[model samples]
Target: MPRININLSHQIVKKFGLAEVDDFGTSPEFYFASSVNLPKNSAFANSMKSEVEKYSFRPTLHAPFMHLNLGSESKEIAETTRKELQWAIDTAAFLRADIIVVHPGYTALPEKKTIEHTGWLDNALPNLDFIAKYSEDKGIKLAFENIFDRDPFSLLLIKEAIGTSNIGFCFDTGHYNIFAPLDMQDWLEALDGHIYEFHVHDNDSTGDQHLPIGEGNIDFTSLQNYLVSKEISELPVVTFENKTLDFVKQSLSRIREWEFLKT
Candidate 1:
């Protein structure tokens, strides 16, 4: 069985009534720590590293997404974004993370200077290639996650252009529900073998609710069946992106029940 994980930030631990990182009992099989929770400084990362190691929890990283666009047409902004992402990659490596999740750069198409969605390929490819090499050198994988993408075809184009084993896909369920024009199966079939992680959350088509699994319209049974048939060779990391510990626990229980019912 693929290990289930939860997204944890400093705020989440605090909300759980825990005063310190160690105070929170380590029951989660894995954790996806937000880059904001992990600053780009060594001291902070090192401090948390001890607590994580003590629990024997495998870790992965969610790179800072806000304003960190690898596809920015402006050279200066793109360069800055690249550096910031590099820091994230380095920090992930420092923590011995198995993989780092990132957003596929977005574009406002029909811009006066840029080449629609394809323009993202310009800056995004080179920077992704750079990070791919960096991750490979550190023995970690980099998974580009989807957000606001209308379809998977554009992502396929980017994936094909890169064509590196170091780079993989991180499918976000809530993002697909709210932002994608197509269904989850369409996206799954498009990136079948390359999926390394699943940001498992729920939302209605109208908004990104981040609700517990099985609460909204997404059919996890269908998703699981597809994965069993298509991606059985690899056990992709599945991280619940619910906001609170209560919701996260509920989502995990829901998944467990679903798995049990399937059996």
Candidate 2:
């Protein structure tokens, strides 16, 4: 059976009445915890490490993206993002997480100021190099996710420039619904062979609704068919990025009931 993971935030834990880290599912995707609780050599991080060992769970991480902007035009802002991401990388290493998810951090520039003129590559590439190397040294993979892009062009460019095996993609379906001007299949086609994970959720194509599967306009059948066509060596990690545990559970059940996925 394919492994299905849920992205755990404080809200989910509260709703589930889970008192300990081990109460998380066997495959846990840890979202960024409260920054106030995260210090250098954080006990919170240590407890997570211990829980992973105790339960023998395979873990993934969603790095902190609040106020992080790797492709910012401001030098200071970019530097701060780099530092915070490095810290996230360290935390992931401590937890022995296999993959750390990140946002691309590039915003659409003014019509005249293209990606080149805005220093998007200049700011993002070096950070990618450093993060990719750091993740490699720690035996973790960095998966850059799509957000706010009308097409896959920016991600494709970043992939081409970096060209590191340890660097991969985490396709977010809800983000695509909200932002991508092109068809979902186009994004999938462009990202084929690079996707290592997924943020699976539904949306109305006008907003990131994070609805249960089949409740929105997303063509999940096509998504399953696309996965079936891929010749990847391992099943990509499928994370239900939802508002609540109940919604995530509903999505999981719907995923299992998909005709193509059942095969």
Candidate 3:
């Protein structure tokens, strides 16, 4: 059965001061902001890690965003992205999280449209190779997310180019809504054997709005039923990736009540 999880963004939560992500009431620290840097064995990681372990909620991680990126066109930026991902992976391992979500890349080409798919492949393969190898050694699966990007094809192309078992996919549902109109099933099939995680959220027709589960137009019931049927063997980590904690928590409450019911 699918389980409720949070995407720890402690800074955002601290700003709002709303607790419990909504009334459905699961611990938000581990699910959302659990992987950020905290004092080593000093009260912080221990306290939050203990909170999650006590609850027995499965943990998943969203690596630092806006700060690091694996697919930066510049070498220095790319290295920073790689290091941040390594930190997130190491922290997830410490917390016993089975999965980590990462944005696969931005355009390796400054002019993505001018380049053919083959040329883009030439540029991204080495970076994917490094991340995939690092993930294998770390024993944590790495999932490249599909953001509504500036590229021409899709991140799926990169997934194919660096065809290694350690690398997988996390399809942000809002991304499809933002950039394309394909139904979720079609998106799932396109990802096929590669999908390992998900960022479940809703959005306005105009952009990646990150609205509550039902507040926007997505059909969560259908998506939930399909995921359940697949019995995804990897313990797929579903994150409520949104802008605000209260709103995200509220959306999670509805999801737990209707979609991921207690089994």
Listed per model in order, the count of residue pairs whose N, CA or C atoms clash below 3 Å is 0, 0, 5
Q: Between candidates 1 and 2, which one is better according to TM-score?
A: 2
TM-score of 3: 0.78
Ten-residue segment with the worst summed lDDT in candidate 1? 17-26
What's the distance in Å from true for residue 246, model 1?
0.4
Per-residue lDDT for 70-174 in model 3, tens only?
A: 555677977776666667777777777777787655533343442244354465566668767777877878777877543324666666666566778877877
How well is each residue in 175-203 modelled by candidate 2, as lDDT tens digits?
Answer: 88887667878888898887889899998
- Residue 79 in candidate 1, Cα distance off native in Å: 1.2
As for TM-score, the candidate ahead, 1 or 3, is 1
Evaluation by TM-score, superior candidate among 2 and 3: 2
TM-score of each model, paired residue for residue = 0.84, 0.88, 0.78
- Residues forming the 10-long window of minimal summed lDDT in candidate 3: 27-36
Show pairs that collide, candidate 2.
Answer: none
Best-matching candidate per TM-score: 2
Q: Cα deviation in Å at residue 115, candidate 1?
A: 7.9
**After superposing candidate 3, which stretches have Cα over 4 Å from the reference?**
12-42, 107-120, 149-153, 232-235, 256-263
